[model samples]
Target chain A: MWKTVVRRLIIMIPQIILLSMLVFTVAHFMPGDPFTGIIDPNVDAARLEELRRAAGYYDPLHVQYFRWVGNALQGDFGRSFAQKVPVTTLIGARAMNSIRLGIVSTVFTYAIALPFGMLSGRYNNSWFDRFVMIYNYVSYAIPTFVLALLFIYIFGYQLQWFPTRGSASPVIPKGTAPYYWDMFYRLLLPGFTAGILGTATTTQTLRNEVIDAKTQDYVRTARSKGVPENVIYNKHIFRNAFLPIASSIGFIFSGLLNGSVFIERIFAFNGMGDLFITSITSRDYSVVITLVLFYGVISIIGSLVSDIVLSLVDPRIRIE
Target chain B: MATDNTLIEVNNLNVGFRFGDEYYNAVEDVSISLAKNEILAIVGESGCGKSTLATAIIGLHDPHNTRIEGEILYNGLDLTKLNEKLYNRLRGNDISMIFQDPLGSLNPVMTIYKQIEESLIYHTKLNDKERYDRVLELLNQVGIPKPERVMKQYPHELSGGMRQRVVIAIALANKPPVIIADEPTTALDVTIQAQILDLMKDIQEETESGIILITHDLGVVAETADRVAVMYAGQIVEEAPVDVLFTDPKHPYTRSLLNSIPNELHEDGEELHVIQGTVPSLQNLPRKGDRFRDRIPWIPDEAFDEDPILHEIAPGHKVRGNSWKYFHFEGEEME
Candidate 1:
């Protein structure tokens, strides 16, 4: 299994390189340069040209790409065009923020989905099952952004339960208990919104799987052994039903990143999603490309982790 | 057949499944008893409710979708009346079942050890060490080599025969008084099928447990069973000692089933007898009259009893309906 993970990591190197190249090329050919709107209108044309030339912006695409790649190899991703700070330094805190939200939201996703799905399936066609079905339909129909906005309006404005915008308060000192608590308190709305949005697929998948598992010959065998219904569910039905859902964790992880874009924006959370959008709009090429690469790497790792997890859960699957 | 040695007695049991709002009896008015150390084989084609009868005996049916009327008396206790908790106590402890598909019957993700231990965990007060030792003993008993190694391996790692043995091991874990094997060897190779049957017989003799062997294979019934019950649609049309059943099948369905098997005595180009029609679906099944009537249409409708019941032809042989007495094949004269 370790060998398989190592091999997967080796293969991912070239995939990440290709992705980086693609992001770079696309950003390079975008409509406007970094200086388009940010620079003063009265600046001398010659000075602007000289500045561009000095920054190697006029270099051939391959030359620029190779230089960037060469620099990136040494952990130097270049300075953000707008921030004038190294891309790594700028992304560090934001990436942590995104990951924190991602973890909490993922926890919420599974915690809500697993029980709901298992029970709904166990008591199939019951009121709870019908309610879950209704919930699934509603969650699926509403877009993540719309749901996030609605949550903000209701919980933030109407009820005044949670803070509406930003990840943390400026008043709270960093690394303190109250600061973390404040962060957590601020995280609930966005985290729950993202979590609820993510639950639809998993809940439906697990529910269907549980239903299928219930009719399986093995379940009957368990029942014949005089195993209690709850034990049969935990020992026989759950693991079998949960196998497919567990294998999908990688895809779900990648999906959460995609979902965070709308959630982070709506909540005004200073995370990778917000960073990504702002960098793209401002044409902060260095930060944008780096963030893209980060996302790509995360997705690759996500799949690997899911594969490892699947092999662990299902003895039938041997990674080697 | 004596009440003193009877392990289970199912009386006028009606096993039905719900379709839309109405209940359709899959196994209707079926009465049979299993004696200690006896192997009673229920023979029928697919969808004939032989498997349903096995499930009913084990109380494995889903109570929500299934309507089971009548008593499954195991040691004077009516299993049909037992709640889930009570049934749980009776199942795997006093009564256990082996299913048809070995691969499907054993949990794919679970190790053989865990699956074998599951029954022991529920039915026995044995601690971890004893259960572990018992699991190995069971594996050895089922003819699996290297019990230690095989116990750790998952179901998929084993062959079909091996998996079936593992399932048998699980069924034997509690040493229950009654073992219901529903077409247990149907999924195995012909060679393995015989071995499994032999193993089951050996286990039954050693444990002195009554076995209900449900199968469509006449040859399997002939080889393994002490008594045979031939089912048609949901009803048992004929039942007798195995030897008597094979030598003197009273029902048209039973005779037709026996005749269908190929033999060396048949001359070249002599076509095998094929039972005429398929068993009717549950919804379309004739709720009254002889259920096997449509399949053997050559027999006159006047010959059938309006409400067919098992009638003793001999001290030990019973045949359902009067139609069997007058039954004859097409293009043949009536005796």
Candidate 2:
């Protein structure tokens, strides 16, 4: 198992390099430069050149990329043009905010989806089953951003339950202790919306998987051996049914990160997605490229994690 | 649990399933009984509802979607009337089934010992150590060499015959009064099939438990079955003691099935006869009038249109419709 994890991690190296390079090149050609934002019309050309030289912008594209990659490997993410701070420091703060919400949403999504899905599938065509199907399709059909706005209106405007937007109100004193609670309060709306949709789709996929697993000969054997219905559902059916869901994690993990983009912006959570929006509009090339590479890294890592998990779930998978 | 009395008596059972818009009967008015320590083999071609009958007798199929009418009396208790709770208690404790596809029937993820231990855990109050000891003994009884090694191995690690042996070990774990082996050796190779049959015979003799062997193979019936029940087209066409049925098959369908088996000990190139005309679809079964129609249309109407019924033509032998006159019952004149 350790060998398989090590091998997967090793394979991820070239993938990360290739992906980062591709993202860097694409962000490089995306219209304006980071120096464009820093340079003023009144500033002298010599002074602008000095700033550009310090930023490594005057170097050849390949040389600049190699330098940036070298610095990135050493945990130096260059500097943000707009923020005028180390890109790593800015990302680190906002990345935690995003991770807080994303992790909570993912855990909640799976917890709700699995049992509900299995039960729905096991009792197909019944009233309860049909209700789940209707709810899932309707939930999935509505855009998540629209749902976010609606939730804000319902809970924030009408119900007066949650705060309107942002990870936390500025009035709240910033400290390590209550800071997470503040983040959770602000994330509740967006996280709830994202989780609902995630639950909807994952439940649909899991439902079909459970239905297939229920028909398996082993399930029939368990039932024939006079195992209780609950035992059959939990041990024999659910464990075997998790294979398709395990394989699906790679896609869902990537989608979760990407889908968080719009939702993150609406909620005013200053995370990677907000960084992406700001970098593109302000033409902060360094920040934009760094964020793109970050996403690429996440995609690759998620896939590796999923593969390792699949091997663990199904013993038939040979690492070699 | 062997006694002078019968263990299970199935009376005029009919099993049917809803096909598309209509309910079609699969096993029609079938009656059979399993005496203590008697090996009763239900033999028929595929789609003959023989397996369905076996399942009905065992109360495995649900009555909600499946319509099963008739009494299945086990120890004077109507199995059909027993609730799911009672049935669950009785299933592994009083009776258990070994399925056809051994690998498919055994859980892929579980260890062989765990699968065997499952029955003991569910049905008996045996402690963990006792269950483990019994599992090893059961594994050994099924002719699995090195029971300790097999106990730790998963289903995929073993060969087809080994998996079947594991299933048998599981079925016998609770020491049920009756063991239903549905085509137990059908999925195995010829040599492996023989070994499994031998193992089952030995187990039955030692345990003294009645085994309801469900299979289409006549050779298996000839080797192990004490009595044979021949089913055709959703009904038992004929039934008799094993030797008597082999020597004097009363029904035309049973006679044709018995004749299809090639005797290796017979003369060389002696072509074996095969039953022609496919078994009709369960949806629209043939009427009683067209029961044994000719394979070739050129033959006279007398070649078919005879509704054969089970009749005793000899002592301890029942044929379908008037076999007492002669073995040429297939050509019997209709009134």
| lDDT tens digits by residue: candidate 1, B1-335 | 53889989989999999999999999999999999999999999999999999988888887889999998898888888888999999889899998889999999898888889999988888999999999989999999999999988988899999999999999999899999999998899999999999999999989999999999999999999999998888998899999999888889889889888987867889999998889999999999998888887878878999898998989889999888879888778987
Identify the leading candidate in terms of DockQ.
1
Model 1: how far residue B112 lies from native, Å: 1.6
**DockQ versus reference, model 2:** 0.57
Docking class of 1: high
Model 1 ranges off by over 4 Å = A31-63
Candidate 1: C-alpha lDDT: 0.89
Write one digit per residue (lDDT tens) for candidate 1, span A208-284. Answer: 99999999999988998888889889879999999998898987877797679888988999999999999988878
RMSD of 2: 3.2
Give lDDT: candidate 2, residue B17.
90
lDDT of 2 by residue, B1-335 (tens): 12356888888788889766667889987878898788999998899998898787767775657888898889888898888888888877888898999988988777888788888878889998998899988988888999999898889889999999999888888888998999999999999999999999999999889899999999999999999988877887788999989887756677667767877655788867756788888876874653444432333554442665665666657665543233342333532
